[model samples]
Target: PEIKSWIDTVLYDSACDSQPLKDKFRDQLGIALEASLNPRRKKTVTENLPKGMKKLTAYGNLVCNA
Candidate 1:
């Protein structure tokens, strides 16, 4: 929800640009990761393909690459 909220804020704010919104998101993500025990790896792998498999896979790949 945080991600979606941030996206909406950025999308609706005419005076704001991507870099600022991205920086905010990065800060939030860092905080979240730091709060977790193992920030580098997922706890479990999904056995079955999720709904919207193509989009889900693409998003996972993008995160891994990033």
Candidate 2:
């Protein structure tokens, strides 16, 4: 969870780190989020989470907080 939070913060603040690290982390997040939408969670691949959040609940919470 701490890792996820760190990644999220890093991704959100692109100017704070190397572009390669941000890009890699963003791509990894996309892959994980894509895998997460695989259907076991009663959610379709077409489910619309937020722009960057990976988990559905996190997606909801992030968007709500935004």
Candidate 3:
């Protein structure tokens, strides 16, 4: 009975200590999943061109006739 009580106490303490770590892991996973699903748009080279120079050919290549 004494050994059983000690084992129970140890297991309970371990579970309590693990709860915060589990929560942190879950939060990080959620952030990673959210970022993957809704990624931020990166700026393209052509996007920074002037209004008149912002032209793309039929094949989507930039045409700088200037």
Across 4-63, the per-residue lDDT of candidate 3 in tens digits comes to 322321212232445555455345432111122111233335656666676654444676
Q: Return the lDDT, model 1, position 65.
A: 19
lDDT of 2 by residue, 1-66 (tens): 346643443213323435565566567653122122223335323346556544444233332323
Q: Which predicted model would earn the best TM-score? A: 2
Pairwise lDDT winner, candidates 1 and 3: 3
CA displacement after TM-score superposition, residue 44 of candidate 3 (Å): 64
Estimated TM-score for each candidate: 0.20, 0.23, 0.19
Residue pairs with backbone atoms closer than 3 Å in model 1 (clashes): none
Query: CA lDDT of each candidate?
Result: 0.39, 0.41, 0.41
The 10-residue segment with the lowest total lDDT in model 3 = 31-40
Q: Please identify model 2 stretches exceeding 4 Å from their true place.
A: 1-16, 31-66
Distance from true location, Cα of 3 in model 3, Å? 41
How far off is residue 31 in model 3, in Å? Answer: 10
